[model samples]
Target: MRVLILGGTREARDLAAALVDEPGVTVTTSLAGRVRDPALPAGETVIGGFGGVAGLRAFLRARGIEAVVDATHPFAATMSAHAVAACAPPGHGDDPAGALAGDPAGPGSVPLLQLTRPGWTPGPGDDWHRARDLPAAADRARALCPPGRGVFVTTGRRQLAPFATDRDRHYLIRAVDPPTDVLPPRHTVVLDRGPYTVDGETRLLRAHDVRVLVTKDSGGALTVAKLDAARTLGLPVVMVDRPAATGPVPPTWPDVAGVLAALRGLAAGGQAAPPA
Candidate 1:
């Protein structure tokens, strides 16, 4: 059995590790290579995009990938869309010709399992302002913070373009890589990765005296410390929502344990996951 994991998250790593040594299984993981030094998963790993949908389909066919598990970041809408199309049955995908958008023959060709963590829910003492996207979040941040006030931005490097022209508020940007996009006039980039602690997150927020916290809705328990820190200081958060999923919802597994079992079952039989 061959499996291709579209991975970059902790769950992806955990799943790859669990399946690497299983009998009759060959697991390969793919990364976007956005990070300078990404945490390597256990099995075979490939970096960078597989072009677009057509390229992905060729690669899938060439590699003889039996099953595909989409474990990309929740905000990775484009890649996720490509995965759906590439795995769709022949003449039933997002091709230039053939299948229309809602064709019944489309959706899944190879067995697909979705491994997505749930989004964070607002809790007591949380001052969360939901934004539709980065530009909207930037506007919300400007509204929440006074001129010359600090805004802590945990949104990734490539996402900084939307906030570039805003010169009123000072930004404390945190990302694993230095931002490639145009930056705000008054901003400091903190290159850091996380499985962060609330104590550390609190200290950073306190040090900057931030009035507003801006972050994406990339959810998982490991990354919730910043939200906790913001809540502790009674600061307002500009929570950018995840881009909506584009196609038919695939079978979903909330955690790595569930997906591991499902994939093993798939190797033994033909059915990989429960119905959508």
Candidate 2:
């Protein structure tokens, strides 16, 4: 069984590691290359984009990939949508959720799966304010945070221009990479990566005197400490909801183990055949 894993997140890496150990399974992981230095997965690895759906289809045919597992970040809606399009079976012409149309990889069905972690939910003692997008979140953050208190922004470095116009509150932006986009007039950048602890998150929040926490609902435990720290500090959070999924959905799982089980089932059933 040949497999292609559209990867970036830890889940994708773990899935690749697990699949490589399986008998008769040839696993290859593809990364978007947005990050400067990424934690590579076990087995064959391909860096950079496949261009688009047509390019992806050509790659799949050339590599003889039998199956695809899109274990990308929850916020990577475009890639996920493209995977559905590129792997769609014959005559799947409908585009309900504004998905980009894709060309099939080959003659027969090239089975695709998705692994997504569950989103965070507001619990007791959580002052949560949901925003439709980053612009909305920026507006809500300014309103909730007083002039003197700073706002901790963790919605990644990209697309931060939405918050640039709001200079009423000082912004403390944290990301794995330094943002290259237009930043707010008064803002500080902290270059860091996650899997952070609650204690560390609390200390960071305390040091900045952050009154408002702005982040995306990009689920998983790696960066969830910020949410917990905000709860402990009684800080209001302005969360940008995950974009509604567009395009044909695949067999989606919440964890690596579940995806492994499904792949085992596929291998047993000889679900996908390598393009000839």
Candidate 3:
């Protein structure tokens, strides 16, 4: 059985690792190549985008990929959309006239699964201002922090452009990669990755004199320390909500173990048990 895992997260890596030793199964993981140097996962790996929906359908048909598991970030809506389209039944896919046409009639019977972590929920002592998108989050951040007050931004490099509109407020932006576009005049960029500790995050908040925390609700242990620190410091958080899923909604699992069990069932030519 051949499987293509659209992976980047730790859960994706874990799933890939679990599948590596399984007999009669071949695994290939694909990365979006957003980060400069991402940690390699087990089995074969392909970096960069698969173009668009048309390109993806072509690749899936050519590669004989039997199953597709989308383990991309929650914010990667575009890629998720393309993946769903690429795995849909024959003429029902996004590209009806493309390379998928060469396949047997009613092709793309592959099982499509999405492995997404749950988003964080606000708890006691958390001053959460939820925004539907990044732009709204920036506006909330601006409102929460007056001029001269700093805002700690952990919303990634690409989304930083919206916050740049507030030139007067200071921003302490942290990202894995450096921003390509020009930042606001009062912004300081910290090129860093996370698995951050509460103590480290506390010190960072203190050093920046941040009054507000701006971040996406990208749920995981690695970046949750910042939220804990914000709660500790009594700072308001402008949390940007994840985008709605596009195309067909596939079965989703919140953790790697669930995904592994499902994949194993699929590889054995059995229907995957519904998520618990």
Number of the candidate with higher TM-score, 2 or 3: 3
Better of 1 and 3 by lDDT: 1
Measured against the true structure, the TM-scores of the candidates, in listed sequence, are 0.92, 0.92, 0.93
lDDT per residue as tens, model 2, 1-276: 899999999999999989989999999999999889889999999999999877787788789887789999889998987787667654552432122111234454477877888899999999999999999998899889999789999998799998898767789999888897899999989999989999999999999889999999998989999999999999999999999976567667788888888788778864422111
- Candidate 2 wrongly placed segments (more than 4 Å): 90-106, 270-276
* Whole-model lDDT per candidate: 0.84, 0.84, 0.83
Error of 2 at 206 (Å): 1.2
Candidate 3 lDDT trough over 10 residues, lowest sum: 96-105
For model 3, the stretches where C-alpha displacement exceeds 4 angstroms are 94-105
User: What is the Å distance of residue 268 in model 2 from its true position?
Assistant: 1.4
Predicted structure 3: lDDT? 0.83
lDDT of 1 by residue, 127-181 (tens): 9999999999998899889998899999888868888888888889999888998
lDDT per residue (tens digit) for residues 1-276 in model 3: 888999998888988898888898889999999999998899999999999977887788888988788999889898988887777776677542221212223546567888999999999999999999987888888888989989998888885788777778889989889987667789889999879999999999999899999888889898999999999999999988999864457778899888788877777767666687
Pairs of residues clashing in candidate 1 = none
